[model samples]
Target: MSASAPICLERGDIQGGILRAYGKRGYPRARFLLFHVARAEAGRWFLEQLRPRVTPALDWAEGGESVKPGQMTRPEVTLNLAFTFRGLEALGVPLRTLKGFPEAFADGMAQRDAVLGDDVGPNRIRFWDPVWHGEPGRAGVHVLVMLNALIAAPDVMTARLAKVTAEVVGLAGETAGGVMLLEGHRGADPRWQELAALWGPQPDGRMGPLASEHFGFNDAIGDPVFDGQYPDGAERDKCRGQGAVDGCGNWRPLATGEFILGWPDESQEVAGAPMPLDFSRNGTFFAYRKLHQDLASWDVWIESRALMLKEVWGLASLAEARATLKAKMAGRWEDGVPLVKAPTFADWQAARARMAEMTRAEQTAFLTEFGYASDREGRMCPKTAHIRRANTRDALDPLWDAKDGKGRLGSALNNRRRILRRGLPYGGRDDPDGEHGIVLLAYCADLFRQFEFVQQQWMNHGLDFDAGNDGCPIVGAHREGARFVIASSDPAKPPFVAGGLKPFVTTRGGDYFFQPSMTALRMIGQGLVDPT
Candidate 1:
């Protein structure tokens, strides 16, 4: 394809979740139901009945027509389905077809404990929820049915979800050979796990606007931008901070194959994809992780580290010290301002207010447009910061050739590792050590290359960023004496090393599942798969 050529996607056949994050749109509440398929026939029947209801990537208008992206009102309730390796076998998928899938999907999240840093500490597999741990009596989780709703009221959302559950259960018999809804959630309804975006309070005590996660950081700031994610004209703007960048300072959406199967990837070829393109083309893989936040520990650690930072940096107030420490660790402020753009505590405070006044597009540009080329020494955003490691941008490029005058070539390398981050926060705020966390759902074509590599190399280990074995302070496994070093631009002031880090986030449970396209779903439901 030429540089000026347009990129198109099979919107109608693709799942809506892959193209859009429902939580970021209008769907603020969700319910995830996991099930075990006992009889292949019944499972196929359930899928056949549910296929028509599955939301597609098309931007559907109120009158049932497909409009251009960003022009239509979203659906009131959106539902998507995915299958585990076990689920596919239980559904009678062909052995040859199953063998074609990537090793990471077959091994699943539970099996790759060591690689993901879940081998020990609170994130160990033993500490996972029963639904994921595979309790002796309970059946293995086979199917994941996700329900996202525009409804925001807690009670109303619960009632609607309960009614939907009852309907689905009725369709699939509740007896032997029928689909079984798995349990082990933290709420009253163990059959389904509830999710809601954290919203702030209004003056009248009503929910005001979208708020940050339990850790007080703005969530879902920078998901990947791929070809056909939005309309052609609209995609260019969205790709400013979220897409692949070139050495010449040009930004463009990544190759479609990086996220969806059967398309030209960043390598400009669609080679080595799973066999039988019909079954794999529009489908994608998903990693479902239930991350529990330790609020009490986070609060204590921040307060303890703030005093040390205050003394080291010679800051005026403990508040500035705490904010600076968080920005250094996260690569962004609590309000989603990037340190590269606003390199000081005062700058972040001013940026927050300025961002509030700008249009949505303008705010996105300000937050994500900056890079680490100028601050290669980790002066503004530390090398160990979560965002820096997660998306290196241009830091991994070769030494800049000033004579040639082109930028670093790191975004080309980072493009292949991009994943579409979806899902919302689960549990409530009543308890500090309670069942409150985010259900992180990431979608990609190759789970191993995109999702697993990022988790193992970037988040769990800092070798890629040249920070030794130091892990991400916010989400990584905190071994003994976990610490984060913040560098200063001034030669007079030495680096501020914030130590004594504890486990702030732990894995409750999760799995690797394949979300097939609408075409593939039909074939699976009809038992028409012929691997040859």
Candidate 2:
């Protein structure tokens, strides 16, 4: 039997931070801290100690008890705790329990990304510069703590996180039995006055530091919303903008199971979960990755490519050509306007201004509301556009032609591949260590069919997408014979084929993690598991 909606979701039981879009809350500061447990007993005790602190997915729930005259809840801080397969064993979880986890999770990130073609080369994790020299390289990271807070008050949040880390570290007393801290964002936050003083500042080019992303594009246009969850009806408007709708002629949020584990997916099947439904019920797997973006090379290539396109298409100037090409490559203009909605360069700029003027409520309606159904010819938005490739939405049929591909199954095919991204772009592309990229936190019920499939088939391969061996233009692996084709609106104009692309986004270090339910975590803390 399949669950229809997330009517039964317990805000207190699920970790909200995993699903919550912290960026909207203006929580510009975040830290992804890694840890290695040295002793079983100490690890177990630490797990027990940390249970009360795990941030639940229910933070958005309305109506809270009022604080007393002398009692005030601290301004909320979002944190989630999850562990790797090795961390599970380190906590003395029975081998039986550990053995039942999804094979993708069991294999860990390094080995699995190899199969998914994540551009991992010989030096292994050293492919990423930050992981190459830092403590993260020298040690194995078994636990991850996703720490986040608003940028308005950084010192307070930083101190709170530091204290939380100190308390957990103090439990083991020494490195032999305690956990070793693998600080990923060392002195990264501008508010850490003391640390910034001692280590100097690490300027991030993403918004709040500068104003937009390093590529000069406005990032994270919007995301999917679920039905019956948002009483505010904000999701309904956003879904309309993202062109998300079910087959019922109904516009609604995505099916709950598309993201949260244990819910019936769009097909009404419970995704593969670990032993003990309670443990995996509210939990989901995360594909944590550090992606490095090379801006210097990209800037040069984009400028050169734009000039070439202007004469071929008879465009106004290099600047107009650049905007059109940028929109074509990214599926949206820098202003978060999708190309399918606004095809021309002028339309995008006008829409960008329109978006700025739209009341917050109006902006929601302006999002993903337009699909490629109108432009079946791939003229308005090419089938190979980066955003189109990432989330095919209603355009799945184009990806699978009967001639050499699976017959039209774009709708059903895309339903199973959906994932809720809980990621934030880290460091500026111009950062000294080349650490400028996104810390991707992918949330989904199944790792293999969702994250891996998208990363491999859709993002890296072109056969299924019908582009003939050309992969994603922006972030796909620069593989052998890799290319991207930009279809021209004027049939008289020849198509532009971009070839011999270099690897733009490089994987630093990563891990596969299972973020358990509050109950499952308590069970782990108490060492109460069937493991059978």
Candidate 3:
């Protein structure tokens, strides 16, 4: 029989970040705290901190949300804690747990920040943020506590978050055995800086806050639904139109282990678990990345290029030309509407209106339900579109099996490499060159096979994806003389190749950390988690 859903998930032990799409839940107020373990029994001390407010997956489901129509009624908060390689050792994690984890993670992302320069062999780190590259003495980041606040507006956010944050440190009149790492220390209170309290986007709006980031796109469009969670809690999603479709014609949810630990992954193997099964069970590796987006340049480039694209597209207006280029680059419009579903901007208005009127489930199915198999020739959607490249759902077939054939392989490969993206935009719509962009947290079982592989093989390079040296349009760090070809639907007219492309997204700083289970947290608190 096929692997069943849930797969005996220890939901009580799992961190909510692994399952909860904070952005989707209207948890806009988020602050990432990086701490250093100062005490010898830092693990024990840290666990003490986690005891009060570290919301677990199961608990969150039962009583985590106070959501209303498009906004959270009261300020609800969630937490997920991760430890650096040094932090784990400082916490006295057992040797077996230490040894059982993936080497890429144990070694940390500081060791493996892949860089690409067109003629890539082994490239050095492209992103050299002082915060990420500095020594431990200077950097001092050990523990990562992601605190997400679900508040309707900014007026009530500050007080609620401050109370929740203080709960961690003020527990039993003890220290967390670490100083927090803040993004900025100037013009801020000493306590805030000490907590490393870097707050993200504070939503404000008429009909609730519009769910979007600096780029004006509907951020966190289709957070891939996993096995444990479904539309109405029990009924499965239909294949015809839904959020994410498997390579198979049937549109089903991804395997539970794709993000959650200790369960059988797409390959039908229980992924790597720390020595004591409970220690790693329900836990997953996390990559916390701070990515910066250059908007001024994007406007300048888009405006100049749209004029050039007018001739290529045979368009009357610059708006049409601009929209077409944006859609081609993003694979979706700014509203998070995929171009594969509606190839032209003209058709998008009705689609968007229809979506707004749809039931939540119907909206998800319509927005997420799409594939590129029908658009193989790149007529509707280009081969090098950002979303197409990022996802590659049914785009490339996995190792073809005589039994399963072609379709199953694409989804099979996609399932194993999936990383749950849970993070928020960090700056406003216009932040010239300020501290802006996204603090992306990717949760996965295997770091190299899932996150790094996608970054290097798919995002940076294009050979394996069959686009031939074509980097992704939006974020792909294309070398000089880089070009993106928009395939023509008409046989007579040739494809339009838009060259002179530069990288829009640049990595600011990031690291790899392991989010352990609540049981493990308790063990660490008790100083009894000895894998050795």
Q: Which candidate, 1 or 2, has the higher lDDT?
A: 1
Q: Candidate 1 regions off by >4 Å?
A: 1-3, 62-74, 202-206, 209-211, 401-404
- Whole-model Cα lDDT per candidate? 0.82, 0.67, 0.66
Off by over 4 Å in 2: 1-6, 60-76, 119-124, 129-138, 153-165, 168-176, 183-212, 227-238, 241-249, 397-410
**Cα lDDT tens digits for candidate 2, 1-532:** 1233335466567775555666655466666666777877777777777777766654342237665432234335566789888888887777777877889898887776566666433224655444323353465667776666645445665776677555655654554647776543423542211111011233453323322455666665655565433433445445564424443234556666777777767776777666777777777788887666787767887888888888778899898998888888888887667888888887777787788778876875676566666666688788887888778776665443344333433466776787777666776544675546666778777888889998888887787657766777887777655667888877888998766566677676577888888988887878886655
Name the lDDT of candidate 2. Answer: 0.67
Clashes of each: 0, 14, 4
TM-score of each: 0.94, 0.85, 0.86
Error of 1 at 88 (Å): 0.5
Per-residue alpha-carbon lDDT of candidate 3 for residues 1-532, written as tens digits (9 for 90 to 100): 1244434455567766567776666676776665656664644665676765667665232255664332322327777788887778777777767788778887777677543231232122444345455464664557777777775557576566777777765642365434444343211332321111223444353434556656556666655656665333342553233323555555666666777788766667787677888787877888877766777767788888899878876777999888888888878887778888888767787788888788977876677777777777778788888777767777775533325544354455665666778787776544443545667888777888888877777787778657787888777776778788887655656677787876667666678888888887787778887675
Clashing pairs in 3: 181-196, 182-196, 242-365, 242-369
Name the best candidate (by lDDT): 1
Leading candidate by TM-score:
1
